[model samples]
Target: MTYDLLIIGGGINGCAIAREAALHGLKVLLVERDDLAAHTSSASTKLIHGGLRYLEFYDFKLVAEALRERERLVKAAPHIIWPMRFVLPHGNAVRPWWMVRLGLYLYDFLGGKMTLARSRGLRSSDAAYTAPLKGGHKGFVYSDAFVDDARLTVLNAMDAAANGADVLVGIAVESARREDGVWRATLSDWRTVEARAIVNAAGPWVHEMLGSLGVNAASNVRLVKGSHIVVPKLYEGDHAYILQQPDRRIVFAIPYQGGTEIGTTDVPVERPEDAQIDDGEIAYLCEAANRHFTKQIAPGDVTSTWSGVRPLYDDGASEAKEVTRDYVLELDTNGPALLSIFGGKITTARHLAEEALGKLAAPLGFRAHPVTRARVFPGGAITDFPTFLTQVRQTWPFLGEKRAERMARAYGSMLAEMLAGVQSEADLGSDLGGGLTELEARWLHDREWARSPDDALMRRSKVGLHLTPAEHDRFSQHWAALFG
Candidate 1:
């Protein structure tokens, strides 16, 4: 079949592009080598933020773009994206309080009209904000939004499919060449397809994908690995903390699930697969947390870890941490058409999609008015998530408060469709542990293209983290029997 656009990659950028193109009345086909968000998209710091530290580098344009997208995403997906407050302590500070305050003022100003609260000072006597600190230090509190990064990618793909796009997983374009005013491509599954234009949103494999097509762009991708570790809960609050390391780098302590997730060391790596955390990364993260929280943590306290390679556009920055988070779209129209995406963060992916499609409109000879701006994602339609969540708990008491909340957040308004005629415990199917029911698992597989249980557990949901070792193994085995 000949398609209007063939998007190669299922990460946020690729999925978002597919969504935009499909919504514009184009025949879109998005193919991913693995499950959606199986890599960097699932391994984010998991925040829809404007990167307050970017102010230090005077990246006003990028910050403003990110902040605008942040508010839009929060309003669109309130269930998966919750407004979170982050505390930045002044003690043992890298940047002075005056400088930090000034930067935050710029941040708020760049954000323009926003529904989120503005930054403020935190006094030492404010125990709720200072109780977890080593010295009960005075600090600053600011607002940003937290996100479920993986589900964001999945929902985009679901939306694309709903709009008549063909979303394929575990498939790749093995080889391709532009011919007869179209790109003829062969898939890993041994099928040939044609498209008027191609998007190399292969992310970390951007350069490699170009090499495979025997094409070249003026830009290159630099792989930087960012790692995070999850430890037992650090404090009693819904808020998160932004800690300053002596290296002038920043680390975040966000309350996640039942643990305090701390992260993100900036280390340059040679390849995309170098996603494993070394002993030094673990030690650095543990020490970063120990320097602030009264409830200290050691490497042994870490319950889980995740790592992802940022495919940053090489800007010749001397240090890895100084690399730009802003994206660059390289459009090479030598033959049919090719657009390669590089260096983007999750917070601005939706905007990036709009920009990407706009860049391709003239080259691909297609244009339809943008519909993604006002369109809420598949399950993100309700006005008030908390109120809707309370209604969910009251309507389906069988799901228990926690499970109901989890489903409500992951699927939002779509949760009701997933539960359709379910009334009692037995109607929902077998309890597969980790709050996963057989019905929900089937829904993820049949509807969401969850090929494996791990896709449902790790990406679409973090249910794997809640499952005990035995339950995890048993559930995987059961899934293999049923779906494999």
Candidate 2:
């Protein structure tokens, strides 16, 4: 079947573009080589932030764009995206106090009319803020939002499918060529699909897709490998910390899934698949954390490590951290229209989608309108998540406070739909542990394009963090039996 747009990549960009285009009444098809967010989208610092450090490089435009998108995303998916307070402790070694304050002021101003709290100072004696930090250190607290990045991508894909777009996962576009005013793409499974326009949102494999189509892109993609480590809870609070290394690079210590997640070293990578965290990166991260927090961490303390290669737009920066995080969209309307996307962060993905569809509207002959702003995702209908949580607990008294809240956060407005007809805990079926019920897993597999147990465990939900090895085996067996 012929389509108006064929998107190659199931990452945030591809899925988001599909949602926007499909919402605009376009016949959109989005195919991904692996599970949704099997790569970079799931491996983020999990922040819907405005790139606070970008101010140092004078990336005002990017920061402003990100901040605007950040606001929209929080509104769009209140279930997955919520306000987070990040504390940046002042040290004599890093940027001066006056400079830091100026940058914070600019960040808040550029964001413009945000629901989150404004930046403020924390005195040295502020016990709650400075308890984990080195003694006599002052700090500043700023607001951003945290997100379930993988879910964000999945929800967009779901929205696209709901709007009559074809969402295919675990299928790679093996080749593509312009044929008689249309682009024919060959899938890995040997199926051929034709489209009026194509989008190369393939992330790291963008250039490879271009090569397959015989289009030599002028812009280059710089593969930068960023790795993060998950360690035991470093601090007692819900607030996250931003630590500055001697190299002027920033590392985050965010409270995640009953633990602390840190690291994300910006090392240049030669190959996209070479996203392994080296010993040096682990050591560097541990040392960076050790310098700031009173609680010291060693390499052995690390419980988990994850790495993702960023397909950043190459600007000839000396260091990986110095490279720009802004996206670049290249449209080649020369035969069958082809639009290529390079370099974008999760915070700005929805805006990128709107911009991408706007560019393709004329060539693809589609009426474009803004829909995602007003339309909420499947589980993001509620305005007040806290009140909704209380109601969820009241209705389902069988679930404890933590379990009910986790369910509400993960499924949001869909929690009731997912838990429909379940009158008691036993009715929910086997506890796969970590509040993950067999019924919930089935729903994810049946509805959310979850193919394997790992997809549900690691990406769809972070229940893997709470599951033991034996429980994981049980989950795997149960998921296989249910799906296979």
Best-performing candidate as measured by TM-score: 1
Q: What is the lDDT of residue 438 in candidate 1?
A: 90
Q: Candidate 1: minimum summed lDDT over ten consecutive residues — where?
A: 364-373
Each model's lDDT comes to 0.91, 0.90
Candidate 2 residue-wise lDDT, 29-133, digit = tens:
999989999998888889999999999999999999999888888888899999999989886348898999999999999999988899989865667778888
Cα deviation of 261 in candidate 1 (Å)?
Answer: 0.4
Off by over 4 Å in 2: none
Candidate 1 stretches greater than 4 Å from native: none
Question: What lDDT score goes with residue 67 in model 1?
Answer: 96
The TM-score between candidate 1 and the true structure equals 0.99
* TM values, all candidates: 0.99, 0.98
After superposition on all C-alphas, the RMSD of every candidate to the true structure, in Å, is: 1.0, 1.3
lDDT of 1 by residue, 329-358 (tens): 999899888999999999989889999889
How well does candidate 1 score on lDDT at residue 410?
92
